[model samples]
Target: MLKGNAYGHGASVTAAFLASRGLPLLAVGDLTEALDIGQAPQTSILVLSPPLPEQLPLAVRHRLHITATSPELVQSLSSLAQGRNQKVTVHIKVDTGFGRLGAAPEELVPLVKEIKKCPYLKLGGIFTHFPAAGGDRIFTAQQLNLFLKLKEEVCALGDCDDVLWHAANSAAFLTLPSSHLDLVRIGTLLYGQSPVSVGAEWDFRTTWQFKTRIVQIRTLPKGHSVGYGRKYRTKKPARIGVIPVGYSHGLELEPLTTPLRQIKHALGQGLKGQHFVFHPMGPLPILGRVGMGLTTVDLSKTPDVYLGDSVTLSMRRVTASAHVPRIYYLAGKVKCILANHEVLSPTGRKISLLGLF
Candidate 1:
């Protein structure tokens, strides 16, 4: 379920579930992430990075669909594909008003013509990244106007029958009405999260949950307190659960106006960077500052759970997605996993963790 902390839900599991659901195509921001999931043969890929000649051969072997915007990139890829005897399928990006990637609206027609002249090169599609689909209607409309102008010019140029038109990303796909585009490349949404998913009305629940067993616990006195600076002074003798995870385990604060925090300690002014695995009574903020190597959680209201008791923390992407570890399951069983350092899967009850590769 792509419903919780992305890393906790397990990347391999999410990848597998996406594949099983017939949503096998994934669009990634760069080559590294594309490479991480590249081993999954069932998943077809589209690399959002601009074309690079040196990387084209690897992209060819990996069967990665790339995005190209200029005559230079198209020319470089055309030549490289020819030298390697491999055909390159590329999606053309347009500069609409976004001024990011893609050629200007006026340049789309001529560029397409030049690309068509390359024998080993295949222009697979046309796509534009929305600069502000969820907000800023003025800029989006201006970009739309430019995109429409390019579309009109291309259709009049010739019948480019095989080209696919795609523009909507996760935010636009949900907020904006679909148009003539053939595909909508989703990123944050597939993990059961989004930039706009807020409040109880938000449909996506986190697909990940993080849990760790108690390492050790000590009964503290009322005035002595616990952890550095003695920031938390217990009102009564209380049993607090000790979990092994800390900031190194990859936790983060969600974006503002988002309900993604789980553990609620009395929030100190210093908690901008530190994060934990659980929420507190009545939405307690995080504790004093996050320690360099360790973090303490306020457990006054944590309950009577003893050592070895499971303490779990849940998260959603209220901010951007963070790089975290994931343990994947199938049918409620651990089938595959993505750790900070390895990729592994279960085959016939035997687990395989790719070592250092």
Candidate 2:
């Protein structure tokens, strides 16, 4: 599943790659994203939040599954479906106490009743989104309780049949299986990382990595200033390596992970450079300010390396601002590509982390 420019990983490209891996189903935030990847046969599409009536016809034609919540929209969908001589499959979203979408508990009775009469609309599934599936047990429990309640009600519907009840995203599927469900729409998990780092028990294996080379090396006298606004100054006459990826490329300098804390000392003999994780307990802590097209690597200790040496940036989804090519892999081999499609040479890799926000 992909949404919000795919949480910084491009949606269209990511969806295509996941589809290549037999993902089978995809969830998107809106109608546009749904249609973008809807045509693939055997691939189910879910528009997390769909648009209004005026904008839904094209999406229906593209074979996307629009998420339905209200009776009015369900009726509208049936009408649209009648015009197309097609039955529109809808994934009914239940709020499950998140106060977001789906019919409220009291409203479900009437909504389900109204939906059963729509001949052209099929109840593909019943589901909800968990607000704290990765962390809060209390809130997660409440949501799960509400989901089970609705599941019973939907199952009781006279003509509803056996609509799938799916309430788990990656977090819920991994940590809370009461909602493991008939189907799960996972994003970060398939990408092999946690969407949130703090308190998350991560088990998914990462599928890809990012790396670039140092374009140049510069040595400066002590106290020399560097970068725009001169954020960092050379304390001692030191050498700095210029990497070909920076903040503009989706890098967040300083500490991009969890609660930033100062470490006492690094491993090895006098490891000079300090290191930090993206989020406390985050799987990857590898990022530099995404430069216009480069990153500033502090290589004072590793100054003996040449300009052509490469540094791989372990990455999950970067921000939309990061307009770079994405290399994909499956089972330790190059499988597919997104953007430019420049084949990367590195075989062994690691996933680098940056904060979700």
Off by over 4 Å in 2: 4-23, 35-41, 194-204, 253-292, 314-322, 340-357
Q: CA lDDT of 244 in candidate 1?
A: 58
Assess each prediction's global lDDT (C-alpha) against the native: 0.62, 0.65
Compose the digit string of candidate 2's lDDT tens values, residues 1-357. Answer: 687556656566566556666776788888866654434444677788745878778778877878877878888888899998998888778787677877677777677777678888777777788877877878998888877877777677665565777888888877777777788878767666775553545456545445666678888788877666665677798776677666566554334343332232223114733332221122222223234665565666553566777566644344524357655555666644445323233443332111100
| CA shift of 292, model 2, Å | 4.4
TM-score versus the correct structure, for each prediction: 0.76, 0.75
Worst 10 residues of 2 by lDDT: 348-357
On the 0 to 100 scale, the lDDT of residue 357 in model 1 is 18
Q: Candidate 1: RMSD over Cα atoms?
A: 5.4
* Cα lDDT, model 1, residue 325: 46
C-alpha lDDT of candidate 2 relative to the true structure: 0.65
**Tens digits of per-residue lDDT for model 1, 248-290:** 5544443233233232322423455334454423222334444
